[model samples]
Target: MNTWCVAAPLCLSVQSYADGNLTLENKGEDGKGKCPFDPFQRYASVMFENKLYSATSMNFLGSEPVLMRSSPVSIRTEFKSSWLNEPNFVSMAHMSESVMSASGDDDKVYLFFSETAVECDCYNKLLVSRVARVCKGDVGGQRTLQKKWTSFLKARIDCPVLESQLPYIIQDTYRWCDPQQPWKDCLFFAVFTPQSDTSDLSAVCVYLVSDISKVFAEGKYKTPVPVETSFVKWVMYSGDVPFPRPGACIDNSARKAGITQTLDLPDRTLQFIKDKPLMDHAIQPIGEAPLLVRRGAKFTRIIVNQVQAADGEKYHVMFIGTEEGTMLKAVNYNGEMFIIEEVQLFQPPHPIKILKFSNVTRQLYAGSDYGAAQIPLATCGRSSSCMDCVLARDPYCGWDTVGGKCIVISNSQRELIQSVKEGDASLCPGADPVKPVNQSIWLGGNVKLSCPSASNLGKTTWEQDSSPLTLSTHLQLLQDGLLIFNASHSDTGVYRCLSVERSKAGEYTTTLAEYHVSIPEGGDDRNVISPEAQINGPSLAGLQVVVGLLLVSLLALLAWNFYKGHLPLPWNYRKKNREQSQETPDQEGLNSCTTYQDAQRPALAEDKPLVSGIDNGSRNNNHTRGAAAFSAAEENDDSTFTPPSLQYIDDESEM
Candidate 1:
C-alpha cells in the first residue's frame, strides 16, 4: 500500500502489508525517505526472480523515461533520446525462454509501448508502437555504458493502420503461453487504436514470440543522420558490426570467448548499442496484417485463452474490451476473423480500465471507473439450439445431442457436436422449429418488422410466402429490420428474415425472424392518413376529404345564421332598392306598389305561399334593374374594358 498527501502531490510514502500489519518501505528510522522510483506516471512493471523490472519516469515531472531493474542490483537504461524518447509505457511480460534455448541463453523481459519515433523524418513528431526486449541476465556495463541494459533493442510493429494513416498506439498487451508448449511457440497479443480522440478504429494483432526474436537477432540496425535542409533521417547501417553481436544476450558462445557478463564486454560494443538501439526491419503480425480491424470501436484491453475443441484442434479465443463498456468475444477460424458475440459489461457505460482472466475459475473479470464485472469464459447456455451453438464457431462451446443443450466442451465428453472451421450443423438430431410472431396491422397503416442480426459478416434476405420479397416504394430493407411505408391487403403474408454466412465448407442459412401478418375483411373506418404521412405530405384522397368537410361546414354555418334572423341581404340588392325609392315615381307606378303591399300584408299571417311569391318577384326585379344600371355606367365612361390582343401594348411608343 501507498499513501500520498493531497496538499503535496509530490510527497509519496510506500508501505508493505504482511500478517495483517502495514510497515513503511521507504521511511527511515531518522525520519527521512529512501524511495528510488516514482509511482505516479503511467508505467509498466513485472516481477522476475524476486526483482522488479519497470519502464517508468525517473522524476516527478515524468519528462525522462527509463527501463530499470530494482533491489539487490539497481540497473537501468542510459538517459538518451535514441534509447527511450518520451515513451508512454503500456504493459510488460516476463517470458522464460531460457528453458528451450540450446545456446544457454537467459530469460528476457519484454516491454510494449508507444514513443516518439527516432527513425522518422517529419515536420511534426511521429509516434510508433514498439516492442523492446531486455535480458534478465543483463547487469550493466563497466566503462562505457555502466548501469544500463546491454541487451536492449526495439523495433516497430508492422501491422496495418487506419486508412487515414494514423499511428496505431499500443494500448494493452497480453502474453499467451500454450500449455505444454515451448515458450518460443507462444504468442503475444496487443490492442492498438489510432489516436484516442480522433479515430474510433481499433485492431487486434497477434505476433509469434519466435518472430520478435528473429528481428532482434538478425535484423539490421538504424542510425540517425542529419540531412541538408530537412529533418534528421534514420537509414539502415551497412557497416561492419562488432564481434559477438551488439545487442545479443551473454550466452554460452560469449562465455567460450571468455566474455559472459555485460560488464566484461569492451566499451566499443556498448557504444554501438547505445547509439543505435532501433532495428531497420519491422515485426509483422501472424498473417502480415491485423487479425481483426473494427471501424466503429476502440479496443481498450484484451485477454486470450486457448481452448481444445471437440474436433481435437486448439484455437485462440480473445476476450476484448472496448471504450464503450462492451466485451467482444472473437475467434479466428481458417484465417478468417469471426466475432462470436458482444455483451454489455457496464450500465451507463464507461471505458474499461482493466481485464484479467483466471484459468482455474474460468471467469473473466473486467473493471471500469464506476464498477467491475465478472463474466464466464464460455456462455454456452445462451445458445439455445444445436444449430445456433454449432454456427457460433466458438471453440469453447459445443452442442450435446443427448442433453439437448449447449455446454462447454471438455476432453471427457466426445459426443458433443461442434464445427469450428466448417460451421456445418447437419450432424444434429433435428432442426429447431422457427416460431413466427403474429402481427395484426390495420389497413393503410405503417409497420416496422424487425430482424435481429447476430454477426456483421452475415447477409440478410427477406422472403414473403416463400417467395423473394421485392423492394418497392412502399417496402424497404434496413440494417436491422424491414419497414413498410403503408401496408395494404397484398402485404399480408408470411415474412421471414434469413441470414446467410459463407465458410470453407459452404454457405449456411439461418432464420433470424419470422412474421405472420394478416388483415381482417372489414376493418374500422379509421383515418387513412397517419401522423407520419402528414409529416411527409398528405395524399390526394386525404386532401379531397378535407375540402369536402370544409365546404359542408361553411354551408351549415350560413343556414344556421339565416334561421336565427341574424343574416343580412346582399349589399348590391339593398343599395339598388334605396336608389329606386329615391327616384320620382309616376301615379300608375305608385298605385301598383300600394296595391301589392296591401295584398301581401293582409295574407302574411295566414297564407305563406302568397307572401313568398311577392318577396321573390320583388328580388328578381331588383337584380334585373341593378344589371342594367351597371351596363349604362360602363357605356358612359371613356375608360371602358377591352379584350386583350396579341398586338396590344400599354405604351403607344413601344407599339
Candidate 2:
C-alpha cells in the first residue's frame, strides 16, 4: 500500500508506485537500451552531493567491472585489466581533501576491495587488498579517455605481520575520524585475512590518508615487459617520469602549467596511464605491521570508538566482528593489543554481516541475515566481586567503593578506583573472606577436590599448607580438580587452589577454592570409620550385669540336675571311682569294667597306643590270652594306631 521506487541497472530504470498503483516506469541509461549497473553482482556504492557513485560489474556474468557515476550517464572507469582485475568491491569513502592539501586538489572518493594480484607470480590466483582513489571532479577526457575516469589508480594496502605471514585479503574496512577535526585527518581501519586456508589468522591494520595519497602521487609505476616466447611480466618502471604524474589530480600545479583538465593533457600522458595504473609502493600500515593479529578468528567487520578513561587518557577501542556472530572488544595499551572480552551477539550463531557503532548512545548495532542486535558497549554490573571487576581491566568499568559494586565510568564521575593497565586488585578497599569447606574422608581412600578457574587467562595451581603442592605418585592435577589416589594420612592438610594471571604490570593471585581435608583415626583398612559410633562409647556397668546373670543361670541348672539324680555331685563321683577301682577283674567283663575317669582323660602328642598286653599281664600270663594278644598286635601294626589318652591336672585336690 506504500509507494516504492526500484532503481534497476537497465538504463537507470525506475518503477514508481503510488496509492498501490504503478505510476511511472522506465529502462536503460541515457534513455537508450544500455545497462549501467549489473543487478546480479554484489556492489559497493556511496553518495556524494546527491550523486551516486558505484563500483560494480557491468554485465550479467559479472566479468566486466567498472566504477561509474549515476548522474553523468556512463562516465566510468576505463575497461582495462590494469585498472581493475576481477575486483570485488567492499565499501567506499567520500571525503574532502581541501583541509590538508597544499596543491588545492579536488576532493576524492576512495574504494576498498580485493582483486586478483597481477603483480605477484604464483601457481594459483593471488588476491590482494587494495585501496583505489578517483578524483571527484574528474569528468573524463575529450579525445583520449572519452567517458572514462582519468584519475583512477589503485595500490596495495599492506598489512604484513611477519616476513612470511601476509594477510592480503581485505574482508571489511571502516573510516574513523575525530568529530572535532577535519575529515582529512581520518584513518581507515581494515580487517585482513590470509589468502591461504592453512591459517585462520585475521588482522586489523590502520592506514593514514597521507600515506595513501603519497603512494598514488609520488610512487613508481610498473610497466609490462616481455620475458619469454609469449610470457610477459610487470616490473617497476625505472625511466624518465612524465610531467604532472600519471595519476595525480588536476591541481593548482597543473593549472600553472596551462593544463587545467584531463582533456588538456597530451596523448602521451593518457597512454602512459592506461598501461600503468598500479602503484609500485604499497601503502604500509601505521606501525608497519598489523594493529592486532588473532589466529583463531576471521574478522568480518570492524568499528572503532574513541573513549576517555578515568585517567583522562583517550583510547581508541575496536569492536571486531567474527564469522561466528561474536564481537571482540580490543584496545592497544602501551603498544600491545589486549582483548577485553568477547560477546556472543546471536543465538545459534549466524555470521555477522554488518556492524555500526553509535557514538551518542554508546551502543553497538550488529546485523546478520537472521536479525539485528543492539548491545551496550560495556556491562559493568555483571562483575560480582571487586577482584573480578579490577582484573577485567575494562576501561569502561570501575570499582565503586561507596556502592560496594562495579559501575560504569563516565566523564562526570568521581571517587571510583580503576587500574586499567595494571589490573592491581590491591587497590581494592577490602576483599571478601575465603571460607574453607571441611571434608572428612577415610584413610587409604580416594577423593577429588574441585577448583574453579577465575579467568580464562589465568593458570590454576594447587597449594598445600601455604606452600606449593609437590607432585607424587598419589597426587595428580587435572583440568578442574586434583585427584588423590589411595589417599593416606600424609595427604591430609589444608588445600587451596589459586589462579594466577600474569600481565606486564605484575601477577595477581586469586583463591578459587579452599578445603580442609582430614582423615579420621582408629579405622581398619577394610572398614570405613563411622562418625556416629566414634561419638558414642559403650557402658562398662551394662557388660558386668549381663555376665552375672549368665553365671547364676548355670548354677541353678546344675542344682536342679543333682536334685533329680541325673547328675552326680563331686563327692558322689569320687565314691563311684573308688568303688570301680576296688572291683576284681574276674567280677566284671573287660569292656564293662572301664572307668569314666579313663574315658575323660585328655589326649597328648607323645602318648603310646593302647593294647591288650596290659589285660594279658593282669590275667597272670595266660597262654591262650597271650597268644591272642600277640596276633592282635601283629594285625594292628599293619592298620592305623590309636594312641592312649594322657591327662595332667594342675591341682589334683581341686579336681
Every model: Cα RMSD to truth:
14.5, 20.6
Question: Which run of 10 residues does model 1 get worst, by summed lDDT?
Answer: 27-36
Compose the digit string of candidate 1's lDDT tens values, residues 560-581. 9877868865885699677777
Summarize candidate 2's per-residue lDDT along 1-655 as a digit string, tens digits.
9985645454333477678876445443442113334443457888798777888876656788888876754578888777888988888998788656778888889999999888876667778888998888777777888777878888888789673454468888899888788775689999988888777788999988878888887888888888775666889999887777777789998899999888787777777887888888889999798999998768999998887777878888899999889999998887879888888998888889889987688788999889899988888877777877887788888888878888888732566787787777788766776899997777676778998756646788989999999999899998889999877778889999998887666887888899999876554356654443445555346667889999999999999999999998899999988887887664443324233223423331122222233443433334454345434533563333232333443443312
Worst lDDT run of 10 residues, candidate 2, spans 604-613
State the displacement of the C-alpha of residue 112, model 1, in Å, after optimal TM-score superposition.
Answer: 1.4
lDDT computed for candidate 1: 0.80
After TM-score superposition, the amount by which residue 497's alpha carbon in candidate 1 deviates from its true location, in angstroms, is 5.1
lDDT of 1 at 513: 91
TM-score of each: 0.69, 0.69
Clashes of 2: 3
